[model samples]
Target: MSRLPLAALVAAFFVGLAWFVSARQALLLLVGVGLGSVLASTRFSFTTGWRRLILSRDPRSVIAQLTLLAAAAAISMPLLARFPTELNAALGPPSISLLVGAFVFGLTMQIADGCGSGTLYKAGLGVPLNMTILPLFALGSFIGSAQMDWWLALGNVNPIGLVQLYGPIEAFGITCLGLIVLALAALIWSGKKTPWFDRRLLIGAIALAVLMGLNLIIAGQPWGIVYGFGLWAAKIATASGFFNPSHNWFWSQPDNSQILSQFVLLDVTSITNIGVLAGALLVSAGKPPARAPRLTPTQWAAGLVAGFVMGYSSRLAFGCNVGAVFSGISTGSLHGWIWVPMAFCGTLIGVRLRRYLNFSG
Candidate 1:
């Protein structure tokens, strides 16, 4: 696809969305494009950042991530505080499922080489492994959501909202302080040799933060990735009569049922997801195609399984790195805070698994 045609197609799609859907959805498509472009151009990957930190004691990517969290928290917390009714936070309960799920998600992401956002953007950039994982990820996400009630039943508590409990000012302060502590820990872990910052990653972080704020303002919710995947799977399953939303606890909710019946374009997350794909395609037009990793049959099987498990675990954990960690922490949800350490522990094991599988990027 040439850049000129790709750009034209994106414009046409935007116009069609505005005409057939709504203006808000159209704008969200643009935001998604910006997100995809930034992520692709900067190579800002959460999975890679953590992996780099673990294997080489590099703190640059990790530091950029912390900066992103701090910046997002700075923007999102205050807006959530003021518009409590209009906006929604990405809150998930502190539960046994959360702990187990986050850990498993972290582990699988390393083997699969992508989290939710990572998967999407990589797929957009035409990475073969991620493209293969995309459908499996959707399937696992649907299954996880279908079984959410059982997971919650195992053990959980009501979600804790720091903004609601401590006010936005205090919540933002806490968020920033925590990020600072993490940054310092990363720096210490990396020793004196590793650089503390990368200008490209810092710019990407700031861009993502601003776009996330725009997402909240227009969509009335923080940015998310997993739910959209699950929803896509649900739509297909229900249509094919392989699954019944009416029988599923998660999809049986009034709002969930409503969206299930509507066009996918009407869904905020879905439209943005489409936009992200389009944006990536647009950006990749003139650039050389990214080289796909070479994998043995066993390695390929391992990656596909990891992709499915990553999807399922993300739902169990309430979100992937993007939905659970990024959006979760930024919006003052306590589960986001809990998600980090457990996922990191999983990553510790995952990197070893990645080596054992002989998967290389």
Candidate 2:
């Protein structure tokens, strides 16, 4: 089938998956696949293609991140107010070790061309090295999760009543969200140095935001791209003998594919990742190979090593820049804030080193 038609089929699949996940109710599989395909195709075209929005420097990405973070924070205010218990965990706020881990994560992500979700997403674009990183992410994540209990002990903070940054620190949450939205709008309107305003980008952003928001509401867990993908791979490698199941990696349990889209099923948003890469290919299929984004020899080595480090940190931190930082911050989690800045600062330094290192496309 053509990518267009296949995409339509996938969109339906995701809608069905979301529905099924939400209600534990089954809808026609064909319907799921079809609607999912359309939605995925739309997002891939608009978000990944038209925007030409690279993660590190794209205005849209930053805007979207800030917007989502603010929204999540705003929504959390009332929720915390209503159900005081849901406000914040008693776990220690970013410990010295977490700060250290975050710094390492920042450096590593810079070395690797992309963060956790970035790896899988780029893999869909058919990068050869990303294929390897996917598995490594799984292995590392398993180790991280297994040792998470120990880290939690180090995370010693009595999470205060919903972070009210203003008049009442609790009020700070929603107020910040509004200010963020305003700021992003201003930035988007300011200039056209790079391609940011596009229908495709808008579509993808809306779709992603909606999916993320809804997931938070029902699952009490955020919508994570990289960790989920890594976990998906973990399931596959475990079955394929790539990993030793006897090690007791915790989440390496049975594939409750009925709930969230498991790795093997090629379900909804997972297919969206597939759709994103495919959509990019379809657009540039006849064009030259993206001019092979130039990189220095050191940058190249950094990319490879950074790739592994990012994978490992995704495991230790329980998510990637997108999943842990973006999604986490959007949901008003403090850890999210910590991770994003650290990773971004790493990017600035990484860019400076790009010409010196063996950076690759």
Candidate 3:
């Protein structure tokens, strides 16, 4: 039927998938879908006639970000203030390690032409090179996790105690429902500054908020894409002779098992990313996936290497854009704001390079 309905159906399935799996996971994937949809909105190359369909400064992205932040704080504050456990979940603020890790991630996003969510969404669009890069990203994550103890030893900065705020807000299905509306209103209002608020913008915002809510209800956390795939790849690679014995052994524990035990910790999240690629392919099949003078083998190789850096750095930083920025902001973490500006700078530099290479505006 309609594109939005299809996305909703996919989201429904994603929620079920996460529910059957684990709440913790669904939460991360929801963040992925939410942000992916908003980013999807931003990718619209507005035309003169379709100005209304285009966005005003494409502000929905910021709206989604802000809506999430406000809703998260509104809910989270009460939860932290009343219940100690909920506060505990949201308190792992970034540290020196986080800053260092995030900056490196920024650099990698620039080189790879995709961050965590960006990579999965682009791959969803059937960018063949993205498929290649996904595995490299996983390998990097495995490396990072394997050495997580070392990072912690170096004062990775774990905020163990809760910085509690106010009351006890529900953390499941109902909460997801409440925030979805807020995200939508924020998006529509945010469009005021742009060229014009269009139907796609409105429809897309609601649909996306729905997607985010589903992920939260199902996964019990935010939606995250890149980290999972990259992690999956890392487990596979370390075991495949690409790395040392110890590297593969830990990840292999769950994955290597047969019957009643499998190690697809982020399986549903990966599928969520799969849905993004499918959505983009369906939308852009009428057009080429890449610009003219498409990337050469060397550039493709560079992209893959860069993707690896993102994987490693994102894991170290505790989240990528979707997790660190989207979910972090949604949870009202201060570092989330810090991350966006840093990432935007990276994007600007990348855009400049793209202009230099492709003469694109």
Candidate 4:
């Protein structure tokens, strides 16, 4: 599609959202668009960044991610402290579920070659593997959500909010200190020979951090990705009589049940998810299609299975890289802090599996 038509389509959707939903929803669609555009333009992928660090001792992307975390925390912590009632942090309990889920999610994301946001934008850019994995990811997310109660039963602790425990300034300072430690570790591991910065990635991180702040302001919640996918799948399954929300602990919640009966565009995450897809499509316009990876049948099946597991694990982990790691840490949720090392450990194993599966791109 040409840029003109693509832009027109996005505008039409924006108008439709404003008319049918609310002005805020429409604005969030634009936020999602910006997210997709920045991600696609800069190739700021959480999955690849970690993978690079693990395989090549490259610190550039890891440093960029730390910068992103620092920037987002600076922007969001104060706002969260200021508007405690209006806004919600991305909080999840520290539990057995989190540890196992984050680890598996990290592992699967490496094999699948995309985390939530990475999968969305790459799918938008028309990557065949990601496009195929999207639905399976949704299916797995729904299944994981349905079984959440069982996971929680294993063992869990109350979620800790740094902003709630400490003042915003203190929380922000703590966040910065943590990020600084990680950045220094990455730099030390990679050595002085390896460059520590990528201009495009730094720019993208700053842009995403600003947009994340906007997301919290407009939606009254931090940015998220997997919930929307599970919701979509739940709606479909419920409509088809394949699943019953009332029997499911997670979906039986007042808010979750209520949204099931409403339009998807009315949902904050869904709208942004749609917007991310559209934005990526917009970026792809007037450009040559990206080359798809080649793999054997076994590799293809492995990837598809990885996508499903990644989806399932993301829910159990309380969020993927974007929702759990990015939003969690930025908003002062301690679960985000716990999620990182577990996911990184998973990635350590996953990269090996990727090589075993003979996946190359």
Flag the better candidate by TM-score, 1 or 2.
1
**Decreasing lDDT order of the candidates:** 4, 1, 3, 2
The list of candidate 3 runs beyond 4 A from truth reads 1-64, 67-93, 160-206, 238-261, 265-268, 281-293, 296-302, 345-361
Cα lDDT tens digits for candidate 3, 139-213: 787677666556656664444322223123433333345446644554465565554345554555455545654
TM-score of 1: 0.99
Estimate, for each residue in 232-326, the C-alpha lDDT of model 1 and write its tens digit. 99999999999988988999999999999999999999987887788788878878887886788898899999999999999999999988889
Q: Pick by lDDT: which candidate is best?
A: 4
The deviation in Å at residue 190 for candidate 1 is 0.5
Instruction: Please write out the lDDT profile of model 2 over residues 1-361, one tens digit for every residue.
Output: 3456655655665476656553321222332222233333443321221122233335654554455455554554444445545433112255544565566666665555556555654554445555456666556655565555567567645322234333234455454755466455546654557554555545555555555444444334444545445556656666788766445434434542332234344343344344444444444344444343655555455566666666666655545665565455554456655655565555556554543464542
Off by over 4 Å in 4: none
What TM-score quantifies how close candidate 2 is to the native fold? 0.63
Cα RMSD for candidate 1? 0.8
Worst 10 residues of 3 by lDDT: 45-54
